[model samples]
Structure formats: C-alpha cells, structure tokens
Target: MTAVKIIKVLGTSAESWEDAANEAVARANDTIDDIRGVEVEDWTAEVENGAVTEYKATVEVAFPVREGNP
Candidate 1:
C-alpha cells in the first residue's frame, strides 16, 4: 500500500494570495521530495495604512511516505 503524509506551512507574498500559496509549495519543495499536492487552508493579510502590505497563506502539503526506510 502507498502511504502519504501531510504537513502545514505558511507562505507570504507582497503581491497576491495566489502567489503566497505558490510560495508555500515552492519553499516546501526545497526541503521535501515527491510532492503530490497542496491544499490552501486559510488566507490572511497584513494591513498598513489601510492598504494590504502583504498576503499570507496557510497550506497543507502532501507527499508520499517512504516505506521500508527510515
């Protein structure tokens, strides 16, 4: 049987929410392998002077679990 694992991560962008989500996956790939998918959990923003200064995204990243190895 194939096994999978999920991890949560936060990503930020000065542009848009979509960019934040993509950033999450990109950063995860830097340290993780076999990335399968990503689920956006939540989104938030930082406001400065009544304007959005940054976008934040909470994402759940999935990857295959290595079997018979530690």
Candidate 2:
C-alpha cells in the first residue's frame, strides 16, 4: 500500500506570516523530498516595542512514505 507521512515543522521570519510558512517548507525541503503539500497549523509572533518583530508558523508537511521506511 502507498501512504503519506506527515510531520510538523516550525518556521519564523521577520517579513510576514506567509513568509514564515514558506520558510518552513523551504527548510523542510533541505532534508525531505517529494514534498506533496503543507498545512499551516498555527500562527504566532514576537513583539517588540508594541510591534511585531517576527512571525512564526507551525506547519504540517506531507510527503510519500519511502519504500523501505515505516
């Protein structure tokens, strides 16, 4: 049978939430292959001086299970 594996990843950026999410996938790509999709699970931020200094995203990344891996 074929299956997909899902994992969680966190990404942060100073630009925007979208950037943060993209960063998660980009970083995950470094170690994972055949990335099928991603789901944004949560959003958070770091604030300084009454402004958002950083944006953080919790992402669920999906990829096919390797042939020999469980």
Q: Give candidate 2 misplaced runs (Cα > 4 Å).
A: none
Model 1 spans > 4 angstroms off: none
The sequence of per-residue lDDT tens digits that candidate 2 reaches over residues 1-70 is 7699999999999999999999999999999999999999999999999999999999999999888655
User: How do the predictions measure up, each by TM-score?
Assistant: 0.93, 0.92
Task: Count clashing residue pairs per candidate.
Answer: 0, 0
Q: What lDDT tens digits, residue by residue, belong to model 1 across residues 1-70?
A: 7799999999999999999999999999999999998899999999999999999999999999997877
What is each predicted model's overall lDDT from 0 to 1? Answer: 0.96, 0.97
Please report the candidate that would top TM-score against the real structure.
1
